[model samples]
Target: MLKRRTRDFHQLSPVANALFHVIAASLAIIAVFPFLFVLIISFTDENTLARNGYRLIPEKWSVDAYHYIFQTGDSLLRSYGVTLFVTIVGTLISLCIITLYAYAISRKSFKYRGFFSFIAFFTMLFNGGLVPTYIVVTQLLDMKDSIWALIMPMAVNAFYIMIMRTFFSTMVPDAIIESGRIDGAGEFQTFIRLVLPLSLPGIATIALFSTLGYWNDWFNALLYIDNPDLVPLQSMLMRIENSMQFILQNSNNASLSSGILQNMPQDTSRMAMVVLATGPIILAYPFFQRYFVQGLTIGAVKE
Candidate 1:
């Protein structure tokens, strides 16, 4: 059996390898520490936090934060469902639209490729603004308060389309497309069967991008959705935080009771809600982890 040879330039010497690992580990810790701190603070008792300020290990531990968040189980679960549906459905639709647009612009044979490309670029530079966009979706289209409100507003991202166009133009070979045509496959068939499978790195990149966009979006729900059932997880979480802040702010007023304020889990519960809302999305990253780097690098330096 032959041993696999590594390129000498790419291979790091022992001390260099150790240094590289050290730097990577330090960066990883820098990225992870804030989230870890948030988790620890969520378990820290509100009294401990008030008395001592933030600490890695609090004088006391409690789950009141989590308890406060989950106290409304039905509302939490319903919001979770709404968010999941929007993210999944929106990501799928957005990926399809972005890929098709990118592919169309990538093909040299397409007569109006330059015109379409100009349109995509134009969108990236300018928009109708929020007021006009809101009017179009709500008054003009009459989709206000619908689930479509959450999904359609951000369905197409121009930046993503550009990334995808770069991938298709520089990475996918013209000969392969021509060969597919020679084999009796139409343009749509070639794209669906051949191009898409070959372009998974780029497709996965767009999928991850769209998934993160849809899952993290709360502003769309805030603007267009008035129906409680259509509210997303992040928006619901914001509402809870706002309510707690309002109650805390007014607690000292003559009309309010100090005892009730003292009992409320404001800081810790907000932290806990942050944890709950972000945990699933963070977990979802592993599915896209493999393709992320590959997709970003392909055709990045193409002529």
Candidate 2:
């Protein structure tokens, strides 16, 4: 039956098949064009960009933007390290917490599932305001200026828990759990050994989401962190942009000459920061591509 269905699925006419391929290619190009354009603009000369107002092929190309970003070598590297640590640790912690909470709520046998699920869902509709949240993180929790400030706030996402819960409820059968129990497996053992192995696609999808959240987060750092060493990559790039703006704004008052300011790669450096920040994260997509698609589609389907 599967083989026959596979054979029948490929029975498109030559014109139709060609049209489909063309559509796919066009969509792929549309998605990739923005990144390619940003990369090109990063290498474009600041003066040329200002004069030409963003061209596909600028009159002059320069690496001044990259040079400016990398000028503070030690700080940049430290920021990269901090960002990497946060992304990796935060994603893992988020996955563990989300998976555990979601799986527990997904089980029909769990009596308190509704109570816990409601708590998670309630957070989605509303949150503690910024001032209260800041006070809690800074004063109550005492996480101010620490790396934990970045990791803890984003650690558990209600939306992700919901996704994982749906995936578990839809995809993982109760029979499997009963079988694990029959085999004398404890709840933890069954979850770790049987359930997790079968839930790879769903887990991978959640991991990718968590990774992007951690990698792109700078707001938490702005609110709670002042330590230079703990500042993540996005926060560092933001500071660079802010510094550029301040210098440009006060260039007249400061001893810095107009020529030096004019030569600075303000526009291109912003684009450069975008390219640098997004490049590594983009590489991660291909790894999760298959699982992400499968997870969303399969989990969304109701039995």
Candidate 3:
């Protein structure tokens, strides 16, 4: 009778259910408001923006900022290409290396798992510092002014490796692995055929994280890329920011022709650039969100 009463209470907890839904709604608003503001501001008119700060709804609307950005279209388009290339290539390479390393460590039979894990973990706690690492990358590796500089240095993160290891350890059953072995499947073959298919959620999570990191990266470009042609989207955005200030400071110059400089909407352009740079990720979120959430939950709960 006590067990039945407890079960009834658990199933019919309206008060608790209401509180959970309220919290969820509040968090959804908190997460969505900033993005809403950004979207509204991106389409807002330059003159209106100059007079007023950001608004939830635009007083006046225009695509002048976007038009200006896409006018010549070479710089923005090239930067986007660079970013896309880096994100896709870097994420794939990082995922492959991280998954292999994580799988190796998750194996109890691997003789050097402990030592390798220690090496990976040690990086998380301590490092040679920025100067030494920069020297090695720029001077030793000669990656400066090259796209490889952006991709290679950040290929593996220790925390990500640990999460992958944790996921493999908990989610992948030992029985499946033993069966693979019984069928004469080698370790590599088993990982390729069996382990990888099961680990898609975790891999997708890591891929999204790595892709965003690569896409939004400016630090690598700031350090390694002096060539304007090699500048990624974020770095190009930084350049545009500085250019806006330059145009505003020299607004009275004779070269400031009627249509070109006078019509340039500096304020709106900045916001539009923000939207342009971030738009891809926002659009991409829906596709990976399910896997991302599942991966994080699986990673958080230990066996």
Angstrom error of the Cα, residue 58, model 3: value is 2.3
Per-residue lDDT of model 2, residues 277-302, tens digit only:
99989988888887766644543213
Query: Across residues 70-161, which tens digit of lDDT does each residue of candidate 3 receive?
Result: 77469889998999899889998999899999999999999999999999999999999889989999999999899999999889999999
Q: How close is candidate 1 to the true structure, as a TM-score?
A: 0.90
Pull out the clashing pairs in model 2.
none
- After superposition of all CA atoms, the RMSD between model 3 and the true structure is 3.8
Please give the lDDT score for candidate 1.
0.88
TM-score against native, each model: 0.90, 0.91, 0.83
**Model 2: runs farther than 4 Å from truth?**
1-6, 290-303
Question: How close to the true structure is residue 168 of candidate 1, measured as C-alpha lDDT?
Answer: 90
Question: Which ranges in model 3 have alpha carbons more than 4 Å from their true place?
Answer: 1-26, 249-262, 290-303
Worst 10 residues of 3 by lDDT: 294-303
Better TM-score candidate (2, 3): 2
After superposing candidate 1, which stretches have Cα over 4 Å from the reference? Answer: 1-10, 293-303
In order of TM-score, best first, we have: 2, 1, 3
Please give the CA lDDT of all the candidate structures. Answer: 0.88, 0.91, 0.87
Q: Please give the lDDT score at residue 27 for candidate 2.
A: 100
